[model samples]
Target: MARMPLAERRRQLTEAAIRAMTRDGVSRTTTRSIAAEAGVSLSVFHYCFDSKQALLESVLTMITDHYIAVVKEAIRPRATLRETVRAGFQAYWDHVAARPAEHMLTYDLTQYALREPGFEHLARRQYELYCETYAQLLEQLGRQTGFELLVPVPVLARYLAAMTDGVTLNFLVLGDADAAAGILDMVTDHVAGLIRER
Candidate 1:
């Protein structure tokens, strides 16, 4: 392969690290494994990241970015708030279904971050990013639908994030896609109810 820019190289390494972690588990993954997965030399890995923790942090950020883009693309302005909310949730479910390994890796990374002393902040920031992304989406939906939210957007966003985390964990553990989706639909309904008709 041709030489890549520093930013592109970093992205490549981050993706490779995620693939390694997904396949080998966080405890088994190492800088050498990530470098081999990326088809780069060990020196390249060191040049791109300060350490394994830094690379994992990049992986977390990448997952967050991917999820936000998926949800944003899934949600569009619709005639009714209910339809808009359902579409967004369905789109997210589809994304998770298509990339179960990547999604599972995210959860694993979260646990790893929490257990590792220096990385606890990454776990906290990951949830914060989730909340902020949802809050922005909810605020925009409210404005577009011309429906006042029963609760503050930020509060609703935090609730949605926490609820989804639980639902996702259960689904991952039980391998029950249908049940997980049903719960998401219920969440959509609840969110729709929060918006009064104009």
Candidate 2:
């Protein structure tokens, strides 16, 4: 039998790890199990990742990075602050809705991150990157629309980021799409009103 290509194998392992974490939760995911699911050997899993924590961190980073890029791309040039906020939320809703399993993986890792040193740093980095990305977009929109932010850009960015994370958890836990949508609309309107008032 031919050996699998290295890049292909790595991708398979990452995806399999995400699925495994989603099904069994990060605490239950092991290198052996991930390798078995990927149809690879334990050595192959080790070759790709130093440990299960690393594998889970990679999965979380993959999900967060992909969504960050999507949200960044969705913000139109010359966008009003309100329009940019709407676009960011829309991107988030679509991404979360489409990849519910990835979101579950994120939640599991988040729970583990509270105690796991390996994942704690990765989680913090991911959160900081996301905040900075959103803050940059917000600042740009503020400049374009001549609407000063009521809160500091960093504070506003963190607030919006936390709100989205909370909404994702609420939607996943309660399966309440209507409530989630309504709350997001309300939050966006309030933020818009604040921006206009400033």
Q: What is the TM-score of each candidate against the true structure?
A: 0.93, 0.81
Task: Give the winner by lDDT.
Answer: 1
What does candidate 2's lDDT look like per residue over 1-198, in tens digits?
Answer: 258887777778988888887888878888889988898889988887777666766776677778878877776643466667687688879898998878877777777887776567767866786687778778766665667877788888898888888999999999898998898888978788768634
How much does candidate 2 score in TM-score?
0.81
lDDT of 1: 0.86
Question: What RMSD value applies to candidate 2?
Answer: 3.1
lDDT of each: 0.86, 0.78
Worst 10 residues of 1 by lDDT: 139-148
lDDT of 2: 0.78
Q: Which residue segments of model 2 deviate by more than 4 Å?
A: 1-9, 77-81, 117-119, 139-150, 194-198
RMSD of 1: 1.6
Give one digit per residue, the lDDT tens place, for model 1 in 60-173.
889878877888887788877778998888877787888889889988888888998888887888899889989988877777777788888889999999988888788878
